[model samples]
Target: MIVLLGITLAVVILVVVTWMLLTRRLREKYAALWLVIALAVLVLGIFPQLLETLTGIFGVQVPANLLFSMAIVLLLGVSLHLSWELSQAEDEIRRAAEEVAILRAQVERIERAISSGKASGVEDADGVG
Candidate 1:
């Protein structure tokens, strides 16, 4: 019964992840990781012995502890990647904002110069004023 439930959940996750990838809601790189995880879950559900073998090889007392440790590690890696991406995006935004401010200042200066020129009638059609 538990195996059936796990298989069902794994299939649901697989379908959802595939849909997200197809809709461009998730990037291919991230989708690849999610697909791998879902497939791993499905395989483990189908063959419960694999986990037992792994636990035995690793000298783990319980399979659940090994699974939990792996999950925690994967989550930590994902969190770190997300943090780095966010930092890069923030830097890009800051640089863009600074460039915009500089451009705006230049525009304001040009406008002021144009207004002053018109007021002083310093620009003449004859090319001399």
Candidate 2:
């Protein structure tokens, strides 16, 4: 009964992930990760006893503990990657804002000079009219 349920769930998840990928809602990189996870679930679903064997091999008494530990590690890795990406994005944004500020200041100065009859639109920034 439980085996059948696991297989069904795994198939459903795989189908959902594939559909999302085809619809362009999910990128190929993320889709590949989801596919890997789904395949792992499918394999475990197909061989329910594999977890038990793995636990024995790893000298773990409870299989759930092993799963929890693995899950926590995976989540930590994902969290770290996301944090790094966010930091990179923030730095890029800051640099872009600084560039924009510099350009705005230059434009304002040019407008002031042109209005004061110091330089025409045809002249360069160094007042080479």
Q: Highest TM-score, which number?
A: 1
The estimated TM-scores of all candidates read 0.88, 0.78
TM-score of candidate 1 relative to the true fold: 0.88
- Candidate 2 TM-score versus the reference: 0.78
- Distance from true location, Cα of 101 in model 2, Å: 1.5
* Residue 68 in candidate 1, Cα distance off native in Å: 0.7
Which parts of model 1 are misplaced by more than 4 Å? 124-129
Tell me the lDDT of model 1 at 100.
100
The residue pairs found clashing in candidate 2 are none
Q: Write the per-residue lDDT of candidate 2 for residues 1-129, one digit (tens) a residue.
A: 887887888899899999998899988877787787778778988997898898999999998887777779878877887799789999999999999999999999978877776544466668576
